[model samples]
Target: MKAVSELLKKHDGTLWHVTPAMTVFEAVEQLARLEVGALLVMDGDRLAGVFSERDYTRKITLLGRNSRETLVSEIMTANVITVNATTRTRECMSLMSARKIRHLPVVEGERVLGMISIRDIMDDIISDHEHTIASLESYIQS
Candidate 1:
């Protein structure tokens, strides 16, 4: 099983974040520009919460709240589920499945390291399966 650290090593370590005070409109714009579903809501260096498309849909649109008037903190997921560098890929998949969440911020103690999506874990698993299948075919031919 691959560790979160190993998976993170395969990608650029860029954590896009927005302050809690930022308007939902701004956050949504950033999400669109970045082509990401979520952004870490940051209070200074702290991980405050996660502002996602789901939050916008459920809390703002469904509730008839104006994005320009609402703050990210108002609709963000306050209780964040985080993983560590040592967490296994399978473990991450399980957590995401149970929580019905797509993104997880990787943390080391109180400091944030990076973020991973369910897509990342699934891709790794698929790649590993392909590698194993190729190895088996090679061995059979030899």
Candidate 2:
């Protein structure tokens, strides 16, 4: 099975992070500008937590809280579930499904490496299916 390490190899090896003290508004703006759905909240190189669009919607918007006043750390999901680059795609998919989360931070050692989404896993599944079909067709032709 292909591992996350193989998939992460295509990414730019960049991890976008924000400080815990940043306001929810700032985090949302950064996420929008970056065209990303999540950001890692760093407490001086430590994975303090994770901020996601859902966090904004549920904790800030739905609750009628001011994004400007609300801190990202207040609503961010702490103790996040992370996977290493060497983790199998199946395992990653399983974790996402079990946790009902769409994003996962890829880590190596104590540093965040990159982020992977459900879309990335889905793309891998589609590619594998296509390859299998191609191989089957070749076998039938032979």
In model 1, state the lDDT of residue 75: 86
Model 1 — TM-score against the truth?
0.97
Q: Model 1: residues >4 Å from true position, as ranges?
A: none
The lDDT for every candidate, in the order shown, is 0.93, 0.90
The alpha-carbon lDDT assigned to residue 45 of candidate 1 equals: 85
Whole-model lDDT for model 2 versus the true structure? Answer: 0.90
Q: Write the per-residue lDDT of candidate 1 for residues 39-140, one digit (tens) a residue.
A: 888899899999999999999999999999999988899999999999999999999999999999999999988788888999999998999999999999
The C-alpha TM-scores of every prediction are 0.97, 0.94
What tens digits encode model 2's per-residue C-alpha lDDT throughout 18-73?
A: 88999999999999999988888888878888999999999999999999999988
Q: Give the C-alpha miss distance for residue 77 in model 2, angstroms.
A: 0.6
Worst 10 residues of 2 by lDDT: 6-15
Regions of candidate 2 where Cα sits further than 4 Å from its true position? none
Which lDDT value does model 1 have at 71?
93
